[model samples]
Target: MKSMPLKLALVAGLGLAFAGATTYAPPASAQVYVTQVGVAPPPPRFERVPPPRYGYVWAPGYWRWDGYRHRHVWVSGYWVHGRPGYVWHPAYWDHAPGGWRFRNGYWAR
Candidate 1:
């Protein structure tokens, strides 16, 4: 019957709509706060930074803690789009009373 074809078209349209909705992901605005104690990370390593890009800021490299290996690992730096009226803060580790706290790189005024 003619109605069968009409119903199939409607179902196909709905399927495509739902498929795209499932793949949608929201943009991330902030980094998760992570902290550790006991073993402090080794001294920061010297990295030769490349020439700066016109419209991007270079984020310096830093050591990140590997929970499974139980040691600090080096994370390479990269460039990010420059935000107007904001400064990019590089990630770093700070020693405090309990342990070392990892501050995520963020855009700040």
Candidate 2:
């Protein structure tokens, strides 16, 4: 009788733990729009390009602005799956009236 109640409690605890784990959601990987006034990102850093990968395109690294640190940070290059009919536009920084604006890489026809 005592053993039965203990087993029941253990099973209930495990079920609750599993239920909590299932409800957890990870943070999104989307980038946020940021505009820095009177600040320009540093020059692009040199990264050794890896050997070509089948059906993939190498996206070069670039300087990314760090808002918290108020400076530029180097983001490493990575391979992206190639799209048959689209071109991969690498991210770049452009001069704007207010400041330097960041344009994200995108696929275009």
What is the C-alpha lDDT profile of model 1 across 1-109, one tens digit per residue? 9999999999999999998985554444567477776788898888899998887889999999888998889999888777767778889898888899898888766
- Clashes in predicted model 2: 0
TM-scores of the models, in the given order?
0.69, 0.66
Off by over 4 Å in 1: 1-32
Tell me the tens digit of each residue's lDDT in model 2 across 1-106. 7999999999999999998985554343345354555788877888999999987889999888777898888899998777677777888888988888887776
The most accurate candidate by TM-score is 1
Please list all clashing residue pairs in model 1, or write none if there are none.
none
